[model samples]
Target: MTDPDPQPWLRLDPRMLLVHPAREVVRFLPVLVGILVAGGASGAGPWGLLGVGIPVALGLVRYLTTSYRITGGRVELRRGLVQRHLLSAAIDRVRTVDLTATLAHRVLGLATVVIGTGSVAADADEQLELDGLPREQAAALRVQLLQSGAAAADDAALPSGTPPVPVVRFAPRWLWYAPFTSGGLVAAGALIGVLSQTTELFAVRIDVTEDDLSALTGLAVLGGAVALVALVVLLAVAGYWVVNAGFSLTHDGGAWHVRRGLLTTRETSLDETRVAGVTRGEPAALRLAHGARLSAIVTGLARSGESGAVLVPPAPRDTVADAASVVLGTPAPMTAPLRAHGPEATRRRYVRALAGSAPVVLVLVGAVVAGASPALLVVAALAIGAALALAWDRARSLGHTLVEQFVVARSGSLRRRRDALATGHVIGWTFRDTWFQRRVGLVTVDATTAGGQGRITVPDVRVGDAIELADAATPGLVAPFLRLGSDA
Candidate 1:
């Protein structure tokens, strides 16, 4: 018999017309600025202002051409004005469904639904997105897409009236840890950079004479520095609180649901089976403050903000660990004692760290001796001391452990991260040996998988240990490739 007819294609919500044009205009605002500038310089009329309509036309074309449908066990999308491309993926391959509503979309009662397959390629066609759907419809669609993959599994069917069990809820106290996370500092820096670039455009001027600077007392300067730091921390805390206002993780319908954000709400769902593992991180500043963050190693998700992989923002270390254990269904592997890399790795760490910091320290010392401020001498000493501390921490953190069916690896000083990846999810193994590594009898083994960063690296381990770890992590996968003689 011939196959049944496919479902009718559905168009995006009409409200998207308004949202898309605004987005397109912002995206090309720089070009629009240039056109206006050129027109003004040439003594032209307001005709150049019509350039804004180009984005509107483009948005209209996008809305007119884009269509999607779920039919014949597949989700298909057809879009593009010139290329007219079509993309489709099997329904069972849907790994995650994300619903996002920016300020504009929320204002228009619209949400964007993103469907991720298990493909990790950067190609745009690997995933399908519906840019404008009613908020309720998008939520329903997300559930439908996620549930379709598990329709045959008995456990996928939740009992009637079963409420979503909350795994983690936003805590007001968590805001105290935000300043140490440095997310705000990064945002502040970006904002400052953008403002600086647009200063001339805005016709802004600043005049601070040397005499004005000299008039400031030492105490006033110190107070200003303290105030600036406080301001940064305060801004960071406020931003964190606002963005993560109602953050919550819940389990229902055989999937993990993450909901967060205030002005721009986001809800993401991933099939429980697609969870490969969890990563526990302690950035230097956050670690010092005894705070930690957690992210899920999802099969089809990128390890970025846009991926909705973050399960816990910077919070108390114990609190993060508790949430991680709940997600993993076992004690978190980060608590396991790792087998350290040998003395050679320690030497490498120290050599690399001092090599980078020595020149800076020397320059500072020279400046101090050449009649610069005595604080330069202190700063040089602090630099050297910081380098040594960092080197020591990096060496200490360089290790790996096998906990149950999960392979755990820890690395980095400034951004210390411990990834505990399930061995069953490992699809391949790669052993890397540079000339120096070979000389030191050390190798970096990458546990390749379709999850998280796509690979978990156990660095600076003995070649024999690396081989053994790989073989043990995924039995028989690496043993057949080994040679009996020196090549082994």
Candidate 2:
């Protein structure tokens, strides 16, 4: 067998000339503005021209120099302005192909094609991105890359009567859980930070006089607080709605296809064979609301913030469970009752929780004893109550279970997560125990794999149970060491 001849180098869509410069300009706009403002204030004009000229020059250089092509069973990219560099990956190694279009790209009918082989190396070699291609071409290229090499051979064609099944779709009710998650708060903080930076640069003023607060009555103040809370919730819900608008997760052609976003659209295809596990996350607020978030544990895929790896946004726990079942090919591991770590683990959780809040509790108690306001006593009581609640939650969250070929670990209080990993994908095992854990005969077992976060930890399990779990997950891997120990 012989590899095909190399294909001719292909340039990015010429339309990128328009998009790239605009992007570069926006990226360096602050510097450009500073240069212009300084030059005007200092009675010099040349610096302003230089600032404006550099980004445009770089954009032009990038558009002219960047080129890529598929050939000889490899996807190759040659891109550099000052230093020539080449990056290539075997077609069989490709794990994901993502197509994205910003508002600008959409307007110009172009998309950025990102080809990922799931490299966890330095960021520079993580993926090959062609900034702009005609939307149709980008889509075609995504298909070609995903359906090439071993992927094509492994990808069985859909049955004649079977169509792609939609596992999850964005729903209006899901937005209710959005506000409970930290998404709104984070977005609000980021928006404020950007506005602060840009407004300060422009000497913009946002006036809120002390007189305004002084004039408010008790009812008015209460109403204002309520309004502020409502605003934050609204912001969070709106942000999630826009970013996840039209979101859908579907399985077809031996890949998981995720389509999402509104103003800046994205489509990602992930090879099903690379999926190793599924994570069901329930943040404190989301859990109270009975909602969960789902994401795939895929080999070599870097966790892209928010948009990356996620199969379903915050939705009903049932919905998340259904999605996880679809991805994992089984529901028992996800839905079955987890095996608790027993009384010792529960005691540890309470001790840790109380220890964390002890300092504040002591401070408040001392204040009340020193003739301070009796309100300090109430605060101390509240602190103790909160710690107890947290301890109970954490204890409840600690559990691990094994079902068939999947090993499930669930833990954490504030951000509880249940990870169901395929034992077949388990590559290694790690056992860790602190002095306290050793005293209690509890060990934390880490199931290391090539997928997801690379390790799934089942914390505070009995030493015997941890060893048994490890041995069960991968037969004979742990038993030999145990036999040696027994013989010794």
Candidate 3:
């Protein structure tokens, strides 16, 4: 039987033709400020106009020229003023569609869509959106693309689907931890900023008296240091939470949709069948709280500048399995047998941890030798010991199981985790060892899958055993079973 026509298509409103006017204004504000600054400094009207007016004119032209239409069978976009351009893609050729909103857009109730064709090039076909369109309009456009059979017809649609997939909604509770957990990287960024400031400030050698140095050692200096550290930590945590807000995933009909981000909101969709694997991860601390993150390894989704894995957010354990079942069209069984590493494996892990801490140890030693305070030595030692303990715990929790059609790996100490990879998803395999590991007759196993690369160091595992596992999981042997048919 023939399928019904897909629901929800978008036709540009005449008003939408002037896309995101506020964005244009915001973008041009800096140029305007630069122009005023330059005009004051150089006392030249033409130069100031060249700097400010050009950007404002370009922004106005960009806003006025761009337009798009989402129809049952295709998406059409036209842009450019003098050098007019038009681009059209059949619903089938479009592999993925994403929606994004920055803080400004959110305030104005607007969002943008990024369309991907699975190409290696950096730019994706994009649409700059304006306000007045309902959220349902974007969701409908995604559904129509999936249901129209565009995903199934194109080889680019790695995980093809039928009908269109349902939208995943973020649970309210998830929003609470999203900011803090996801913002960890932001905190790291803030810390880096603080250090940069400190470095730059300290580098300037002002010839000053001993009283100047003493003045620098006053309460203001100490308070500033403490405040800077606290601010960095807070910013990091806030960034994490903001980035993860409104996280959701759903598969209805044949497509998969993921919506996330707070200040810069994003929505991404793909063919359900193209997904290759499902991974669940938990950091040591999150394990105690029974929290875990979900991610899918799909063929076309690119992370960084290259093809890599895309991690879904800090999902509950139950949600991960549900998302996997929907996206992959197979039940994700909990098959990874939990087993503690052998004593030798644990010892090797501890040694590896110590080796990793060597740089910190050496830095601390140098500081001590340079007449640094004893507290610095104590802090370094404590940090190193804590890191080692965490690594050992993770090693102790490591386990793997080979299933008939999939391989499951479970690892984590405080936050237990599992990853399920269909055998066909295995793209390549490698066995690695450092000189120290080889001397000890141990090796680490690395698996390259269609979605991205993942590694599990079977610390102190017999080299022969590691080699066997690598061979068994090799692409040549595993691809046949795991590889989905083109029509999938």
Clashes of 1: 0
Model 1, range 1-488, lDDT digits (tens) per residue?
11398689999999999998999999989998898899889967575767788999999999999999888778889999899879898878988888888999989999999888866666765558899999978877776677778643746455346667688889899998989977778877877788898997898988899998899889999999898788778879988987787899887777888888988888888788888988888888889999999888988666653347888888899888888888888884868789899899898889889989989988998888898998888888888888899999999989998888899999999999989999988999888888888888988889988878889888889877788888888898788878841374
> What lDDT does candidate 3 reach at residue 43?
90
TM-scores of all models?
Answer: 0.85, 0.90, 0.67
lDDT of 3 at 417: 60
* Candidate 3: stretches off by over 4 Å: 1-13, 17-20, 34-60, 63-78, 81-93, 102-110, 124-137, 148-241, 261-264, 305-312, 315-335, 338-344, 358-384, 410-418, 434-441, 453-488
Q: After superposition, how far is residue 386 of candidate 3 from its true place, in Å?
A: 3.0
Clashing pairs in 2: none
Model 2 worst lDDT window (10 residues): 154-163
Stronger candidate by lDDT (1 vs 2): 2
Tens-digit lDDT track for model 2 on 6-93? Answer: 5799999999999888889999999988998899999898888899889999899999999998888788999997788788888789
Model 2 collision count: 0
Instruction: Between candidates 2 and 3, name the one with more favorable lDDT.
Output: 2
Query: Which numbered prediction scores highest in lDDT against the true structure?
Result: 2
